[model samples]
Target: MSEKNERQLRIVGFLCNWCSYGGADTAGVCRFKQPPLLRIIRIPCTGRMDPLFVVKALAQGADGVLVSGCHPKDCHYAVGNFYARRRLELVKRFLPFVGLDPRRFHYTWVSASEGQRWQEVVTEFSAVIQELGPNPGIGADTPMETAGQAASAFA
Candidate 1:
């Protein structure tokens, strides 16, 4: 296979520090085998997640984006996860509208104590991403004007 075809696709993960990040860490420390595709970004809380972050990631060549945070009503910030749920849902809906596959994005909740759950989540999400293969990030030939227009709509 050509080197380009053999390269791994990028999977970006936005994890809440108090819960999902810790859960992921625990999974690592416990030596659970999981896909190494994900690159994690630890956020203070899910409520802090901006929909644009997902858009930018997709536009910047992320094959898939996984957002994991504290379980509803179990968030350390009380209602942060709730807000994240609302925002992420809307983002999911908007994905297809932007000429991007909605399946490339996923959001879920995982608690800090759920290392096994974290392992399962990553494994499942990674499998789906691999199936989808690499993303071109809006296509290399797309005019800058159109890209800016799409981004500005979200702004």
Candidate 2:
């Protein structure tokens, strides 16, 4: 592996802006250390996440994916987190159909005030990804080899 790839695991985080994202920001501002592997993408709400996008990231060679949003009863947008929970659960159950391990994907809740919880969440998830290592991908090409190209396509 190249030095760059060796330096960071390909872990993607799709965080809801109103809650999880803020929580992460708080972690940073508070100087609570987090793993360097997690690359964050702030979304309006987890309810807006498309299952396909999570699959696509894994297919493109991401070692792990984390989707976090507001707590169930505390979503800024009412039932938004509920919708996200349902979709993410369905996707988690069927990861094997796409040749990905269910363990590679995770979803959870963290409010804006939960900076310490955010640190714990990221640390735990990053360890899981490190244990899993690289994904060889479903097809002939390996994810590590094609991830750069595929990641750019989506970014």
Candidate 3:
């Protein structure tokens, strides 16, 4: 593979233990093809994932972040996914304010049995990031001001 092709995106995924994580594990067991970029971090519930954790992952050089959990009304924690909805909405708004493309982050719901959906999400997310190319923050010392400008442009 060429260097560019070999340049792997570092993605930090926060998956709900009850659903999305299980779905991903099932995908593996079922031998469903998925992008290798994703590095999943399982959480008890989507509600348990703090926005700071997402920010920390970005700061640590992840090219993108994905947060997944049980579908609404399907959370093992009863209503935890609803809480995640509100939190992720705010996160979507704030990431743009911080000069990151809102596209760099994603949130979704997948049931434990949705291995096909899990594969689809990973493949699609990886393709999107590949098209966007490497994160400037990781490859270069992009000033916040510059990133802010880029964000404004994207906006």
Candidate 4:
């Protein structure tokens, strides 16, 4: 493979242990060929997700972030995913304000039994990240004014 093809995008997946993570495991057992981009972090529940986690991942050079959990009203912890949905939505919207591409972050729900759905979600999100390319990263050297100007231009 050419260097370009060999270079996999750095994607981070924060998966809820009860559902989405199991779905990913099921996809693996089924031998689904997902893009080898994501580095999965299994969290106890979607409620445990912190917006700073996504921000830190992007700031540290992750190309994209994906947060998957149990379907709404289907959370193993009852309403964990509900809280996740709200927080993740806020983070997704706020990313652009900080000069990051909002498209670089995505969140969804998947159940443990839905192996095929897990494969589809990862494939689709990976393709989207590939299209967006690598994250430019938030730099410390750039003055706040310049960064704000750049953010506006990006908008």
Candidate 5:
């Protein structure tokens, strides 16, 4: 995290409304520190996620994206996680096709009360991203330019 060129990787996080989102909220209320790198976007269900959203986040300068939802048998929407799993499988392939580090994307499940788990996940994911270094493709076009400009160009 201290390297001069180690860009602070912007991360977009998609969390299921009922579980993962609440878990994140709980973490915050409990003061469980997690990396500020992530920007959380709550969705009605994991099934609501579109592959386009993932691509767009990456294109817009997010060095990584994380998707969290209810566990397999815990989804309030019953099958939302199932659909998400299937769709992300394709995203997994597409990341590599575009020369992105496939490790930039991560998926997990966090229940409403799992504040500790939520914190742990963020810690691990952020660590991995730090290890991978910054996403060169997103900022390669304009290293000295404003992040917004770079993101727009990538997008």
Candidate 6:
């Protein structure tokens, strides 16, 4: 592979502890080979997800962000995933407004027992991110001091 192709993409994965994290663990136990690009963060529940977290990841140069939780109503905390779904959707939609591509962020549901499903989700998302290449970051073309000055002026 060429050096560019051999370079690993940086992907951040936010996984709910009750379901999605377990699902990823299960995939590992099953010896499924998956892309090594994802750096997983375990959250208590999807309800705990904050849109700013996704923004921060992208701003800090993550090539992509993936959020995985329980399957809707099947969330261990009952309504957690539902809230997550709504919040993540807004984040995805708003990304473009901030000069980031919506394709760099994704969300999905995976149950603890669905190891194979986790593998598939990771594989697919990883490929998409790899194709998108590294994220240029939020306002990367703008100088930080200039951007900060503009923000302060607005305030």
- TM-score rank, highest first? 1, 6, 4, 3, 2, 5
The collision pairs in model 1 are: none
Tens-digit lDDT string for candidate 1 (72-153):
9999999999999999998888776667788899999998989999999999988888877787666345666776687678
The window of 10 residues in a row where model 1 has the poorest summed lDDT is 136-145
Tell me the tens digit of each residue's lDDT in model 6 across 7-124.
Answer: 6689999999999999999999999999999999999998988778887888787899999999977988889998999889988887766677889999999999999999999999
lDDT of 4 by residue, 1-155 (tens): 54433466899999999999999999999999999999999999989887788877887889999999999999989999888988888888878667788888999999999999999999999999888777777544446576556444423
TM-scores for all predictions: 0.91, 0.84, 0.84, 0.86, 0.83, 0.88
Candidate 2, pairs of clashing residues: none
Reference-based lDDT, each prediction: 0.88, 0.83, 0.81, 0.86, 0.82, 0.87
Candidate that would win on TM-score: 1
Q: Which candidate order results from sorting by lDDT in descending order?
A: 1, 6, 4, 2, 5, 3
Model 2 regions lying over 4 Å from their true place: 1-7, 139-155
Local error of candidate 2 at 125, Å?
A: 0.6
Better of 3 and 4 by lDDT: 4
- In model 4, pairs of residues that clash are none
Q: Whose lDDT is greatest here?
A: 1
Residues 6-36 of candidate 2 have per-residue lDDT tens digits of 6457888999999999999999999999889
> How many backbone collisions does model 5 have?
0
Q: Which one wins by lDDT: 1 or 2? A: 1
Question: For residues 1-155, could you state the per-residue lDDT of candidate 3 as single tens digits?
Answer: 55544677788999999999999999999999887899989899998777767756765778889999999998898999998899888877867556567687899999999999999998999888887666655214456776545444433
* Local lDDT at 124 for model 6: 97
Candidate 5 — worst ten consecutive residues by lDDT sum?
A: 146-155
